[model samples]
Target: MSDVNTTRASAPQWRDLRETVQRNCDIADARYAGNDTLCTYLLKMREFYRWERGLPYSMALDRREVGDWVVAREQHWEGLEAQDLDALTLGERRFDPFDHEAVNQHLSPHGLVYGAGYGRGARPLFFLGSLIKLEDYEGYRIYVVGQEMARDLSSPPAMSRGERIFVRRESIRRMVFEMIEAWQMRGAPAVDSLGRALRAYGHDPGNDESLERMVDAEVESAVWHEVGEVLAGRLLGPEWQERMMTVAGSRAERVMRAVRDHLADCLATLPALLDDAPEGALHFYFANLGGMRALLFPQLREAYEGWVKGGTLEELKRLIAPAREHWLTVAERLLREPPETWPVSDEALPSLCPDFSGRRLG
Candidate 1:
């Protein structure tokens, strides 16, 4: 760190710079104590000086030029009168910082004042982004300038009412509390949008870390929920009717798979249900048929028994064989189609599907 001068400096230039800032601050304190324009300029100068302290002595200005720059900025804002209100209306027009006329009234109103030439011409100008609350220094609010590169400008720098006024230290604390409470009142969507603006402006709430984290979590959660819906809709496609139906479809899928597998296995076990007669063919047929009685829907089996009772052995064979074929066809079709497309029967025992299973009768 550079050592401070042990006594008041002998340099006239340093003395003049000191006298100029003090005189300006005092004049602004008297003339524009509550006038927002002068307060805004002083705030900006306070910040500029705070930052300039870190620069090398040779690079930092401590001359009448710095004083004149501050005065010019204040004058620019102070020049606006009631008649110039039309230029400040900004009805539908967007803010443009370099378009001097567009921002004439808003510059001081939004807590920024212009300054030029810090070290070199290529250096982009700075905007006072921080608020200052002078505790006992009642007449003024100090604003600090931060560098914003103007290499390319499609839009003006971010500004808001929050940055416009500097409050007392106690008032600043109250403001922070009020802002957090207000944010909590907003919905997640609004909070997310505001969070983006805050981040873009590089506004940090050092002591209000919890507030920031809560807003971030809410925004992140909202984004994930949106992503989940999009993915589910894309994957579910036309089959997805609604959220409730999607869930029901998942349950129906498991039921269809079990039914298909049971029918396919039974078909695999059948030797050859054609006219070729095996010795004790009736007993062999009955053995494979016992388990199937438990599987087939009661109404369906009853309907088929009604058709075959007191008929010839050949009649039984004809009825049973066709019933088995119908079940195999239904099972294969279910497997081929998507779950949502799988057919559900309205009738308990239809003439077409004689071997319908108890798995999903409806």
Candidate 2:
């Protein structure tokens, strides 16, 4: 039989294996609910193994499949042993599911009879069951199916299992967009702060090169076109044809204006505190300002807050003065900085204020 035929013959049997793995994961999830830290860690390990290798179980106890499963199982067991499981309750009965002697006695002539639980042969199987679970079974399914598909095609497949699992290009695009959405939601404050710092130095935050780098060209086109339609709905009261014809520039400018208005609203809430204020008052003012900064730059908020609460206003200001200067330089350079030089391409922003190559007053 050809390799393809061999894989085809094996495919039907794989379903039962996947179902068993899923069922096991579900059991693990139920058993470890209160002990979430251990549960999550073990579940993630199972997920990683499933993704990296295939399922850690076999449909038949044939020497090849069973031996492979045993090794994978032992590795998982050793990992679990390294963790603290004192708080876990196995309900007064620690179950030994794999027994070597019984397995050995009942084996088919071609089958390997590993002992059930009591002997050396059963030890590896016993350890394997301790860590493998079905809670992350879907991920395992994806992993196994993806791996099988890839392995059947070639020794190392051209496209990854992730690509196959996420089939259609549109589906992959949607997944990427969802990832970007989640990231932005979590990092909104930091992004906003970076925008504010850019605007403070007379740079157009809307035209920020860093922001452009973060979004792919195709996505950018789709976003702005959607923004145009939304703006037109608000401005011209939602006539479909009129909205489609509205200039993109007009929509973009409106967005920039709205952003600036929102910033003005936030600035209005700031409480007055001067450099000469007492340490206590300075701390209060710093706390309040830090809160505003948090709304714009969440990543730096804790450190900024710590600096504020640590000492007198003068001392804090002196500590951050260099950073403030650096921020100014970065802002000024944003307009002239080559697109290739921006660190935003790597999904990171400068940790501190950074200097620019050339100075442009505007």
Candidate 3:
């Protein structure tokens, strides 16, 4: 059979797969949707509603309609909160959801990709999408998915699980547009970094094509970070995961996450971004960089300022290797002691890692 006809012949089966994925997605959203603040919850629901309805970017949403939809969705989630994530079935064979490598071995031949992983607060996230293509990056399987067939509420654009990396272009597109929209709403006060990044890409507010282009460019950025994450995973070893689980949802977890994040960025993201990415990619990297990360490494922030003022990347690029070692050392230090023995005060968490410049910042 011709390729189109072959795919047509499998539509029913694929729909079954998508249905399973979405069902599990709803279950996840049901259990974890309340973790955010009320404002954040409402905004996410508003965007989730838009994605569910396939609304155009330019379409004006009716506020009352969105509010009502959120209420209804919450009711639906309440129903699903107690359910367990179901195993995926292909033909008559069932596969574990977390066993993505095994699952993809079955799906890839049919132009499908599946991913299941955890996010903040240890929330489970899952998705299935059309296989855009695949590649090998440093012995890792890169599963790039397009036009996500199913997704949960908190859709991260990219994630790394074991040796597989899943890049969700569809999520990236929406996230890029959302970032710009959020900025436009309040003039994105960090104009020097974020604004300049937008301008570098000719990002006209509300321009869908501009949004698409930005998303395309950012795929590399996302991939690099995840690859770094994989490397960071290797450097820290399994004890790091033990440490993360020990502190999950606590302030200390944020410090753990931030240090490892800096390690990953320094190892994989920063160097590649400085060498190959547009000036704006680097800018956006720093602009969006805040929270525990900015506090953990104020020196890097200062380095960014020097680069901004000097109009050269040397100062920035020079920091990557050393920063990588610095973060890795800090990560090992954090894991040196068991979580039960760690300090009780959240205030002491920032001290877990050495100060960037002063005594402590984050």
Candidate 4:
């Protein structure tokens, strides 16, 4: 076998940064209790991994939906004059955060008289009506400030909702790093140490043959469930949920099962690609690597940019094989691990590995 010099100089670990991000998320969740806009931003940031992986956008009700509920509440703000009606209409429209004029027009009716300032520059802005929405059901009002207003309304480093959310997300990232670090300190194992670590942190290890199995199951479930919802929504329109149940019902189970099986098959072949790796390199690459580049490099032009920026065809040629190999390792490992091991929660499961195996990647 030909040896590939796959050495990489290790940089500072990301443990601190990840913890900071998680702490910020906690702070944001506490600080902005009833502020729907602020809460949504913070929540999104806190859950960056889900989004980055292209998971479903957290379901929440929009302003128009909320206003409709408000109308049902208090008997539709009964006995208001023509101006009040216009105001209510405007208020309903303005809940979108993108509709500033409507919000400005209906500020008084919407009870937003407190400092309803003009939107920054010429861009429109509207407060988010509510962070949660349910059809034919009333929900609380939540407001959000747009990016432009956040920038303009700031006074000497006062954190905006965006900033707060960013901090929170960073905290989450840090927490993940710390978990990985703990695993490393324990002598990086190939078995299910991640599950054990999760259990130590009070998480469920789940009933699976291996930690990789649990992770794979969870990811598969999450992805397919979201995909089903998306497909239902697209196919059935507004009544997708009901229609999906009506049409597919138990069939959804069969479909997901098939998809999972297919995904498993794809995952199985990944390990073979790692045979040529320079020893412990695969483990390191699999644990740290992320993003689409790891999955779909052929479709990405940026990968090609590596060829353009570097000189000598040989140098470029040398880099591609290793990079591809690294990604292949990551894919292989992901398929191997259980999904429960992936999420960083307080209630983690126990590691399958009584004695840690494998060497650390650098």
> After TM-score superposition, what is the CA distance of residue 136 in candidate 3 from its true location, in Å?
0.9
**Candidate 3: segments with Cα more than 4 A from true spot:** 1-10, 188-190, 340-362
- Model 3 agreement with the true structure over 1-362: per-residue lDDT tens digits: 01211132266768888898999999999999899898888878888888889887788899999989988988888889999899999878899888888898887787788899888888899998888768885688777778777899899899998778888988887777777778778867655677878888887775677777778778878888989998988888878877787677877787788888899998889888888788778877877799888877777888788877865777677667666767888788788876666643546655654444532221
User: Model 2, clash count?
Assistant: 19
Best by TM-score: 3
Off by over 4 Å in 1: 1-281, 284-310, 340-352, 355-362
Ten contiguous residues minimizing lDDT sum, candidate 3: 1-10
Cα lDDT of model 4 by residue, 93-155, tens digit? 314332333443443233221112111121111122111111111221112211111111111
lDDT of 2 at 242: 29
| Steric clash pairs (candidate 1) | 43-143, 47-144
TM-score of 2: 0.19
Q: How does each model score on TM-score?
A: 0.19, 0.19, 0.91, 0.19
User: What would the C-alpha RMSD of candidate 1 be, to one decimal place?
Assistant: 31.8
lDDT of 2: 0.28
Model 3, C-alpha of 179: deviation from truth (Å) = 1.5
Q: Which lDDT tens digits does candidate 1 get at residues 292-346?
A: 2434434433433443354344444444345545555655554456656544433
Q: lDDT winner among the candidates?
A: 3
User: Which candidate model has the greater TM-score, 3 or 4?
Assistant: 3
Candidate 3 to truth, TM = 0.91
Higher-scoring candidate on lDDT, 1 or 3: 3
